[model samples]
Target: MAKQFERIEPAHREMMGRQAIFFVGSSAGDSRVNISPRSTTHFHVLGDLSVAYLDLTGSGSETAAHAKAGGRATVMFCTFDSAPQILRLYGRPRIDFRGSEAYAAFLAEHYPNGEPVGARQVVTIDLDLVQTSCGFAVPLFEHVGERPVLDRWAEAKGEEGLVAYRREKNTVSIDGLPTGLDEA
Candidate 1:
Protein backbone atom coordinates (compact mmCIF):
# COMPACT_ATOMS: atom_id res chain seq x y z
CA MET A 1 0.00 0.00 0.00
CA ALA A 2 1.00 3.62 -0.45
CA LYS A 3 0.71 6.67 1.78
CA GLN A 4 0.27 10.28 0.79
CA PHE A 5 0.93 13.58 2.53
CA GLU A 6 0.35 17.23 1.89
CA ARG A 7 3.83 18.15 3.12
CA ILE A 8 7.04 16.40 4.05
CA GLU A 9 7.31 15.30 7.62
CA PRO A 10 10.44 15.31 9.75
CA ALA A 11 11.05 11.59 9.31
CA HIS A 12 10.62 11.93 5.58
CA ARG A 13 13.17 14.70 5.47
CA GLU A 14 15.59 12.55 7.42
CA MET A 15 15.16 9.69 5.01
CA MET A 16 15.66 11.98 2.05
CA GLY A 17 18.86 13.24 3.62
CA ARG A 18 20.17 9.70 3.74
CA GLN A 19 19.52 8.99 0.09
CA ALA A 20 22.60 8.73 -2.10
CA ILE A 21 20.88 9.07 -5.43
CA PHE A 22 17.52 10.31 -6.66
CA PHE A 23 15.54 10.30 -9.91
CA VAL A 24 14.04 13.42 -11.45
CA GLY A 25 11.17 13.01 -13.91
CA SER A 26 9.66 15.72 -16.02
CA SER A 27 7.55 16.35 -19.15
CA ALA A 28 6.36 19.40 -21.01
CA GLY A 29 2.97 19.18 -22.75
CA ASP A 30 3.12 16.33 -25.28
CA SER A 31 6.88 16.13 -25.43
CA ARG A 32 8.77 13.00 -24.49
CA VAL A 33 9.15 12.50 -20.76
CA ASN A 34 12.58 12.32 -19.18
CA ILE A 35 13.64 10.47 -16.09
CA SER A 36 17.23 11.11 -15.10
CA PRO A 37 19.22 9.65 -12.24
CA ARG A 38 21.24 12.14 -10.29
CA SER A 39 23.96 11.43 -7.78
CA THR A 40 24.97 14.45 -5.75
CA THR A 41 25.51 15.70 -2.22
CA HIS A 42 23.92 19.02 -3.00
CA PHE A 43 20.27 18.73 -2.12
CA HIS A 44 18.51 20.62 0.65
CA VAL A 45 15.12 20.82 2.28
CA LEU A 46 14.14 24.41 1.75
CA GLY A 47 10.90 24.02 3.70
CA ASP A 48 8.21 21.51 4.47
CA LEU A 49 6.87 22.03 0.95
CA SER A 50 10.03 22.94 -0.93
CA VAL A 51 13.27 21.23 -1.93
CA ALA A 52 16.14 22.11 -4.22
CA TYR A 53 19.18 20.52 -5.78
CA LEU A 54 22.16 21.73 -7.68
CA ASP A 55 22.00 20.76 -11.32
CA LEU A 56 25.30 19.82 -12.87
CA THR A 57 26.24 20.04 -16.48
CA GLY A 58 25.15 16.87 -18.23
CA SER A 59 24.67 15.44 -21.70
CA GLY A 60 21.01 16.45 -21.72
CA SER A 61 19.17 19.41 -20.25
CA GLU A 62 15.73 17.92 -20.51
CA THR A 63 14.74 18.79 -16.95
CA ALA A 64 15.60 22.40 -17.44
CA ALA A 65 13.84 22.54 -20.77
CA HIS A 66 10.73 20.98 -19.34
CA ALA A 67 10.67 23.23 -16.31
CA LYS A 68 11.19 26.29 -18.47
CA ALA A 69 8.24 25.19 -20.56
CA GLY A 70 5.99 25.00 -17.46
CA GLY A 71 6.17 21.30 -16.90
CA ARG A 72 5.55 19.32 -13.72
CA ALA A 73 8.34 17.33 -12.14
CA THR A 74 8.58 14.50 -9.70
CA VAL A 75 11.58 13.70 -7.56
CA MET A 76 11.91 10.19 -6.25
CA PHE A 77 14.12 8.84 -3.51
CA CYS A 78 14.38 5.12 -2.96
CA THR A 79 16.22 3.08 -0.39
CA PHE A 80 18.82 0.80 -1.96
CA ASP A 81 20.77 -0.07 1.19
CA SER A 82 18.29 0.24 3.98
CA ALA A 83 14.52 -0.05 4.46
CA PRO A 84 12.43 -0.79 1.42
CA GLN A 85 10.65 2.47 0.73
CA ILE A 86 10.21 4.87 -2.14
CA LEU A 87 9.23 8.51 -1.69
CA ARG A 88 7.97 10.62 -4.56
CA LEU A 89 7.57 14.39 -4.55
CA TYR A 90 5.26 15.96 -7.10
CA GLY A 91 5.68 19.66 -7.72
CA ARG A 92 6.15 22.66 -9.91
CA PRO A 93 9.83 23.09 -10.65
CA ARG A 94 12.02 25.93 -11.84
CA ILE A 95 15.52 26.13 -13.23
CA ASP A 96 17.81 28.90 -12.07
CA PHE A 97 20.73 29.39 -14.39
CA ARG A 98 24.33 29.45 -13.16
CA GLY A 99 24.87 33.17 -13.06
CA SER A 100 21.52 34.00 -11.51
CA GLU A 101 21.09 35.34 -8.00
CA ALA A 102 19.02 32.34 -6.96
CA TYR A 103 21.83 30.02 -7.96
CA ALA A 104 24.35 31.99 -5.92
CA ALA A 105 21.99 32.08 -2.93
CA PHE A 106 21.48 28.34 -2.97
CA LEU A 107 25.21 27.77 -3.22
CA ALA A 108 25.90 30.02 -0.28
CA GLU A 109 23.21 28.55 1.94
CA HIS A 110 23.34 24.81 1.37
CA TYR A 111 26.65 23.79 -0.17
CA PRO A 112 29.20 24.09 2.63
CA ASN A 113 32.01 23.12 0.29
CA GLY A 114 30.95 25.92 -2.01
CA GLU A 115 29.60 25.55 -5.50
CA PRO A 116 30.30 22.24 -7.20
CA VAL A 117 32.82 22.34 -10.02
CA GLY A 118 30.44 21.43 -12.82
CA ALA A 119 27.35 23.14 -11.46
CA ARG A 120 25.20 24.71 -14.16
CA GLN A 121 21.98 25.60 -12.42
CA VAL A 122 19.66 25.01 -9.49
CA VAL A 123 16.41 23.03 -9.71
CA THR A 124 13.91 24.05 -7.08
CA ILE A 125 10.69 22.15 -6.47
CA ASP A 126 7.63 23.50 -4.72
CA LEU A 127 5.87 20.39 -3.61
CA ASP A 128 2.15 19.78 -3.81
CA LEU A 129 2.15 16.12 -2.84
CA VAL A 130 4.46 13.62 -1.23
CA GLN A 131 3.86 9.93 -1.56
CA THR A 132 5.55 6.91 -0.06
CA SER A 133 5.22 3.33 -1.15
CA CYS A 134 6.60 -0.03 -0.10
CA GLY A 135 9.40 -0.69 -2.53
CA PHE A 136 9.41 -4.44 -1.99
CA ALA A 137 10.85 -5.14 -5.43
CA VAL A 138 13.72 -2.69 -5.32
CA PRO A 139 17.07 -4.41 -5.26
CA LEU A 140 19.63 -3.70 -2.59
CA PHE A 141 23.04 -2.41 -3.59
CA GLU A 142 26.03 -1.86 -1.33
CA HIS A 143 26.98 1.70 -0.76
CA VAL A 144 30.02 2.98 -2.60
CA GLY A 145 31.59 6.36 -3.11
CA GLU A 146 30.57 8.98 -5.61
CA ARG A 147 31.97 8.65 -9.12
CA PRO A 148 34.88 10.92 -9.99
CA VAL A 149 34.41 10.85 -13.75
CA LEU A 150 31.92 13.75 -13.85
CA ASP A 151 34.06 15.94 -11.65
CA ARG A 152 37.13 15.13 -13.71
CA TRP A 153 35.33 15.90 -16.94
CA ALA A 154 34.01 19.17 -15.59
CA GLU A 155 37.45 20.24 -14.45
CA ALA A 156 38.90 19.44 -17.82
CA LYS A 157 36.19 21.42 -19.53
CA GLY A 158 36.77 24.56 -17.46
CA GLU A 159 34.32 27.44 -17.77
CA GLU A 160 34.59 28.17 -21.47
CA GLY A 161 34.67 24.52 -22.39
CA LEU A 162 31.61 23.82 -20.26
CA VAL A 163 29.66 26.62 -21.93
CA ALA A 164 30.63 25.37 -25.37
CA TYR A 165 29.74 21.85 -24.45
CA ARG A 166 26.35 22.97 -23.19
CA ARG A 167 25.75 24.80 -26.44
CA GLU A 168 26.64 21.75 -28.45
CA LYS A 169 24.92 19.10 -26.36
CA ASN A 170 22.46 20.60 -23.88
CA THR A 171 20.80 23.35 -25.86
CA VAL A 172 17.75 21.33 -26.86
CA SER A 173 15.82 18.47 -25.34
CA ILE A 174 15.29 15.19 -27.18
CA ASP A 175 11.92 16.45 -28.39
CA GLY A 176 13.47 19.62 -29.85
CA LEU A 177 12.34 21.95 -27.08
CA PRO A 178 14.76 24.73 -26.27
CA THR A 179 16.42 24.09 -22.88
CA GLY A 180 17.29 27.75 -22.37
CA LEU A 181 20.87 26.67 -21.91
CA ASP A 182 21.97 28.65 -24.95
CA GLU A 183 20.80 31.84 -23.30
CA ALA A 184 22.48 30.97 -20.04
Candidate 2:
Protein backbone atom coordinates (compact mmCIF):
# COMPACT_ATOMS: atom_id res chain seq x y z
CA MET A 1 0.00 0.00 0.00
CA ALA A 2 1.07 3.56 -0.68
CA LYS A 3 0.10 6.75 1.07
CA GLN A 4 0.76 10.46 0.50
CA PHE A 5 0.87 13.42 2.81
CA GLU A 6 1.57 17.14 2.63
CA ARG A 7 3.93 17.14 5.58
CA ILE A 8 6.22 14.78 7.40
CA GLU A 9 4.44 13.11 10.27
CA PRO A 10 6.14 11.94 13.43
CA ALA A 11 6.34 8.35 12.21
CA HIS A 12 7.97 9.57 9.01
CA ARG A 13 10.54 11.48 11.01
CA GLU A 14 11.27 8.42 13.07
CA MET A 15 11.84 6.32 9.98
CA MET A 16 14.09 8.96 8.49
CA GLY A 17 16.10 9.19 11.66
CA ARG A 18 16.51 5.44 11.88
CA GLN A 19 17.70 4.97 8.32
CA ALA A 20 21.40 4.45 7.83
CA ILE A 21 21.41 5.99 4.39
CA PHE A 22 19.20 7.80 1.89
CA PHE A 23 19.13 8.44 -1.83
CA VAL A 24 18.97 11.87 -3.43
CA GLY A 25 17.55 12.32 -6.93
CA SER A 26 17.60 15.42 -9.10
CA SER A 27 17.74 16.63 -12.69
CA ALA A 28 18.04 19.90 -14.60
CA GLY A 29 15.48 19.23 -17.35
CA ASP A 30 17.72 18.29 -20.27
CA SER A 31 20.72 17.24 -18.31
CA ARG A 32 21.39 13.84 -16.76
CA VAL A 33 19.33 12.82 -13.74
CA ASN A 34 21.47 12.36 -10.68
CA ILE A 35 20.98 9.82 -7.90
CA SER A 36 23.41 9.51 -5.06
CA PRO A 37 23.42 7.51 -1.84
CA ARG A 38 24.23 9.53 1.27
CA SER A 39 24.96 8.65 4.85
CA THR A 40 22.75 9.97 7.63
CA THR A 41 25.52 11.36 9.75
CA HIS A 42 24.43 14.96 9.17
CA PHE A 43 20.87 14.47 8.01
CA HIS A 44 18.44 16.78 9.83
CA VAL A 45 14.69 17.10 9.99
CA LEU A 46 14.35 20.84 10.42
CA GLY A 47 10.58 20.91 10.61
CA ASP A 48 7.41 19.35 9.32
CA LEU A 49 8.23 20.34 5.77
CA SER A 50 11.98 20.76 5.72
CA VAL A 51 15.04 18.52 5.82
CA ALA A 52 18.71 18.86 5.05
CA TYR A 53 21.94 16.95 4.81
CA LEU A 54 25.58 17.84 4.66
CA ASP A 55 27.08 17.45 1.21
CA LEU A 56 30.64 16.22 1.38
CA THR A 57 33.31 16.52 -1.26
CA GLY A 58 32.54 14.15 -4.06
CA SER A 59 33.55 13.40 -7.61
CA GLY A 60 30.49 15.12 -9.07
CA SER A 61 28.35 18.01 -7.90
CA GLU A 62 25.41 17.15 -10.09
CA THR A 63 22.88 17.73 -7.30
CA ALA A 64 24.16 21.22 -6.69
CA ALA A 65 24.20 21.90 -10.42
CA HIS A 66 20.68 20.63 -10.78
CA ALA A 67 19.52 22.77 -7.86
CA LYS A 68 21.21 25.77 -9.41
CA ALA A 69 19.36 25.09 -12.64
CA GLY A 70 15.96 25.24 -10.98
CA GLY A 71 15.38 21.56 -10.53
CA ARG A 72 13.37 19.75 -7.88
CA ALA A 73 14.81 16.89 -5.88
CA THR A 74 13.51 13.70 -4.33
CA VAL A 75 15.02 12.15 -1.24
CA MET A 76 14.17 8.55 -0.41
CA PHE A 77 14.68 6.51 2.73
CA CYS A 78 13.90 2.83 3.17
CA THR A 79 14.06 0.49 6.10
CA PHE A 80 16.85 -2.04 5.66
CA ASP A 81 15.73 -3.77 8.81
CA SER A 82 12.51 -4.18 10.79
CA ALA A 83 9.26 -3.28 9.00
CA PRO A 84 9.50 -2.68 5.28
CA GLN A 85 8.58 0.81 4.15
CA ILE A 86 10.05 3.41 1.82
CA LEU A 87 9.59 7.13 2.24
CA ARG A 88 10.11 9.69 -0.48
CA LEU A 89 10.20 13.46 -0.11
CA TYR A 90 9.73 15.62 -3.20
CA GLY A 91 10.89 19.21 -2.92
CA ARG A 92 12.98 22.12 -4.09
CA PRO A 93 16.60 22.19 -2.94
CA ARG A 94 18.85 25.01 -1.83
CA ILE A 95 22.59 24.74 -1.57
CA ASP A 96 24.44 26.70 1.09
CA PHE A 97 28.06 26.70 0.16
CA ARG A 98 30.91 26.23 2.61
CA GLY A 99 31.43 29.85 3.62
CA SER A 100 27.87 31.07 3.54
CA GLU A 101 26.04 32.29 6.64
CA ALA A 102 23.32 29.71 6.15
CA TYR A 103 25.94 27.03 6.10
CA ALA A 104 27.54 28.33 9.29
CA ALA A 105 24.23 28.59 11.09
CA PHE A 106 23.15 25.15 10.02
CA LEU A 107 26.42 23.78 11.31
CA ALA A 108 26.06 25.62 14.57
CA GLU A 109 22.56 24.30 15.16
CA HIS A 110 22.51 20.78 13.74
CA TYR A 111 26.15 19.86 14.08
CA PRO A 112 27.14 21.01 17.54
CA ASN A 113 30.20 18.74 17.62
CA GLY A 114 31.57 20.51 14.55
CA GLU A 115 31.33 20.23 10.80
CA PRO A 116 32.66 17.03 9.39
CA VAL A 117 35.85 17.21 7.42
CA GLY A 118 35.46 17.66 3.65
CA ALA A 119 32.00 19.16 4.01
CA ARG A 120 31.43 21.12 0.83
CA GLN A 121 27.93 22.43 1.35
CA VAL A 122 24.59 21.96 3.05
CA VAL A 123 21.69 20.88 0.82
CA THR A 124 18.35 21.87 2.27
CA ILE A 125 15.03 20.74 0.85
CA ASP A 126 11.68 22.38 1.37
CA LEU A 127 9.46 19.37 0.95
CA ASP A 128 6.13 19.69 -0.81
CA LEU A 129 5.06 16.07 -0.86
CA VAL A 130 5.72 13.03 1.24
CA GLN A 131 5.00 9.49 0.08
CA THR A 132 5.37 6.10 1.61
CA SER A 133 5.08 2.67 0.08
CA CYS A 134 5.62 -0.85 1.19
CA GLY A 135 9.20 -1.87 0.48
CA PHE A 136 8.66 -5.60 0.58
CA ALA A 137 10.89 -6.21 -2.41
CA VAL A 138 13.82 -4.27 -1.09
CA PRO A 139 16.51 -6.52 0.30
CA LEU A 140 17.56 -6.26 3.88
CA PHE A 141 21.18 -5.61 4.64
CA GLU A 142 23.12 -5.80 7.88
CA HIS A 143 24.70 -2.68 9.27
CA VAL A 144 28.43 -2.93 9.48
CA GLY A 145 29.89 0.50 10.21
CA GLU A 146 30.71 3.80 8.62
CA ARG A 147 33.75 3.72 6.38
CA PRO A 148 36.67 5.89 7.43
CA VAL A 149 38.04 6.30 3.92
CA LEU A 150 36.38 9.62 3.18
CA ASP A 151 37.28 11.15 6.51
CA ARG A 152 40.87 9.95 6.17
CA TRP A 153 41.11 11.26 2.64
CA ALA A 154 39.66 14.61 3.60
CA GLU A 155 41.89 14.91 6.61
CA ALA A 156 44.92 14.22 4.47
CA LYS A 157 43.78 16.76 1.87
CA GLY A 158 43.26 19.48 4.51
CA GLU A 159 41.42 22.73 3.72
CA GLU A 160 43.68 24.04 0.97
CA GLY A 161 43.90 20.72 -0.81
CA LEU A 162 40.15 20.24 -0.47
CA VAL A 163 39.50 23.64 -2.07
CA ALA A 164 41.83 22.70 -4.90
CA TYR A 165 40.16 19.34 -5.34
CA ARG A 166 36.69 20.85 -5.38
CA ARG A 167 37.88 23.42 -7.91
CA GLU A 168 39.17 20.66 -10.10
CA LYS A 169 36.54 17.97 -9.84
CA ASN A 170 33.36 19.62 -8.62
CA THR A 171 33.08 22.76 -10.76
CA VAL A 172 31.17 20.92 -13.50
CA SER A 173 28.76 18.04 -13.72
CA ILE A 174 29.41 15.12 -16.00
CA ASP A 175 27.09 16.66 -18.60
CA GLY A 176 29.08 19.92 -18.54
CA LEU A 177 26.69 21.90 -16.38
CA PRO A 178 28.15 24.50 -14.03
CA THR A 179 27.96 23.16 -10.45
CA GLY A 180 28.43 26.54 -8.72
CA LEU A 181 31.36 25.11 -6.81
CA ASP A 182 33.69 27.49 -8.53
CA GLU A 183 31.78 30.44 -7.17
CA ALA A 184 31.79 28.94 -3.69
TM-score of each: 0.96, 0.97
Which whole-number lDDT from 0 to 100 does residue 83 have in model 1? 88
Residue-level lDDT tens digits of model 2 in 30-94 = 99889999999878999999999999998889889988888889999999988999999999998
Clashes of each: 0, 0
For lDDT, the strongest prediction is 2
Clashing pairs in 2: none
Model 2 ranges off by over 4 Å: none
Candidate 1: 10-residue stretch with minimal lDDT: 36-45
Colliding pairs, model 1: none
**What residue runs in model 1 are displaced by over 4 Å at the alpha carbon?**
none
Find the 10 residues in a row with the least total lDDT in model 2.
Answer: 175-184
lDDT of 1 by residue, 147-183 (tens): 8999999999998999889889888899999888777
